[model samples]
Target: MILRQHGPQLLHHIKILKLKKNLDEHLNNLLTSPWVPENTFQFPARGKRNLRFQSQRQTLESLSDSLDIETSSKALSFLKSTLTSEFVVSLCLLANILQSTISVYKILQSPYCDLKSAVEHTEDSVDHFGNIQRTMDVKFSKIFITAKALMSQVCEEIHFPRVAPHQHYRSNYSTKDPESYLRISVAIPIQDDLINQLKCRFSDRKDLLGTLQCFIPASTTETVDAEPLK
Candidate 1:
């Protein structure tokens, strides 16, 4: 027999059977004894509770709690999953732009953050937390919103051609006005930060482009341990 033809139905039937078994076990336990303690079968009014019943109750409660926790954890995990690839690429591009606009004075200051750190470095701390603080600085404020909007526009403009002939015809025929394709050209300013990041990341690699990182910061800082003369 062809299992593929009826696999779904067979699997559902198996699940139903398993559910029925669980229900039967639970019902048998409840029906065989009393919902509350039964004094008729017992000598005392409040005799010792059935050990089997106690075990079943505990098992059911624990299983119920476990199922709840599993369901909630899965939902929370799904909700917290990263944004779309397009969105991620857009955000990365935005950071690239803002990094371009940062002043030389800002780079030498405390926290001494760099855009190369975001791209070249593979640490989560730099990506999520450090970049956020660096982006919020005054020097980066001008290009931040513009960069984001530009990225969004670029994503929206790029469209894929229809695969099926019927789909293509239907889409074209249903439209009252002719749809014209817009050419989107992005002139991403190749700033020093971008160059530095590219250079740092691809310097040792052979197959990558290696000419981007040649910009020098306007200022540098050095710490020295001074000796005190008595």
Candidate 2:
């Protein structure tokens, strides 16, 4: 959920409206170009071939690097200056979160792992991201909005565990355009998808492994009507 869907999706939100293309057509009569060396920003992709998702964090990091260079340049035009510091900071923090997801993915990839442990990791990761969303709301105002929007979208994609409203628990999400209602936390969906996927892949095999472990072969098998032969 984190690497492919939520993480990548979140990175795209942070990059939205920030990366402009065909600057030559938009800006006119600019003296020196605002383009920086590609080496200053771009990173190699780590996605599998033919995969649905690509390297989101890597792309964000590259975009961020480009903006930072442009922001500090005195000769740059309004295009470069338009990339605000707040946006850059939020993208960086989000990229940091993505880096942490690699460890959890590694745990799932290992051979002979416990289902319970995988669920625990999912639970912990969900809770951790929930707390992170809250923290971002407090620390980084710009990030809070983007983070909430990302969570809202991720929740829609991960429609599992069936969130039900109650007295103590209630969903704080709205499907409005400008993201007026931004209180959705996708921790449950993320964890639910993980646990369900794990079970679907491993649960049935558990019974078979148990039977195999406890099996014993007999030296000589008797027929339905046993006969004592010399």
Candidate 3:
């Protein structure tokens, strides 16, 4: 039912998405230009494996210094360490996804009316997010969404303040600048049920709700209060 009602609006959002993709490409091109080339290298996968194994072996050697190390025994030790490193890395990657999902769930459950309020209410969200931007060597300027014309929750702008020097990434040229970022629009088909869910979640947290509600308006039961209803 929600999709049916917002399908046309979703199509309109696609146009904005295309524009976002183009903007991202342009920014990437500029950021990766000769003068501000992103520091990246293609390490041979095999070499990476070797280094992983070596690091593990060194760790084990330090912990178990009293262990007897014979010539053939050392070769076996190296193989075991390499396999362990591969397993550890794989597990870490999986764990990262799980952790990210949990964080998303928490943000959704919070009493913020929309994503913007949620960010502000939980300043930790921004701090951790800033850390991630640096570690991931990437940044997100904004997110855009479009709903029905009658919906009054559309955002005029989303702000990301300047990242502190310690928190800023090496490749980000605007580290000292007041945080330059791209803008994104979200044009998902919206529904009353979804709006109600958001409102209910934020019912107890009025202060935070104000900010969020500004971005995602409540779904009105009657057309009289609707923004663009005709």
Q: Name the candidate that leads on TM-score.
A: 2
Clashes of each: 2, 0, 8
Error (Å) of candidate 2 at residue 29 is 30
Q: Which stretches of candidate 3 lie over 4 Å from their true place?
A: 1-57, 67-82, 85-89, 92-96, 99-224, 227-230
Better of 1 and 2 by TM-score: 2
Please give the CA lDDT of all the candidate structures: 0.39, 0.43, 0.39
- Steric clash pairs (candidate 3): 143-184, 144-184, 144-185, 144-186, 145-185, 145-186, 146-186, 146-187
Q: Model 1 Cα displacement at 52 (Å)?
A: 5.5
Decreasing lDDT order of the candidates: 2, 3, 1
Stretches > 4 Å off in candidate 1:
33-48, 52-230
TM-scores of the models, in the given order? 0.20, 0.27, 0.19
| lDDT by residue for model 1 (26-109), tens | 556445553235432221111122333333443353334333468546544542322222333344444544443343323423
Arrange candidates by TM-score, descending.
2, 1, 3
Writing each residue's lDDT as its tens digit, candidate 3 over 56-172 gives 444443333323356336646754543332233333333333444455555666566575556454454434544644543222211111111101222112233444466434222
* Number of the top lDDT candidate: 2
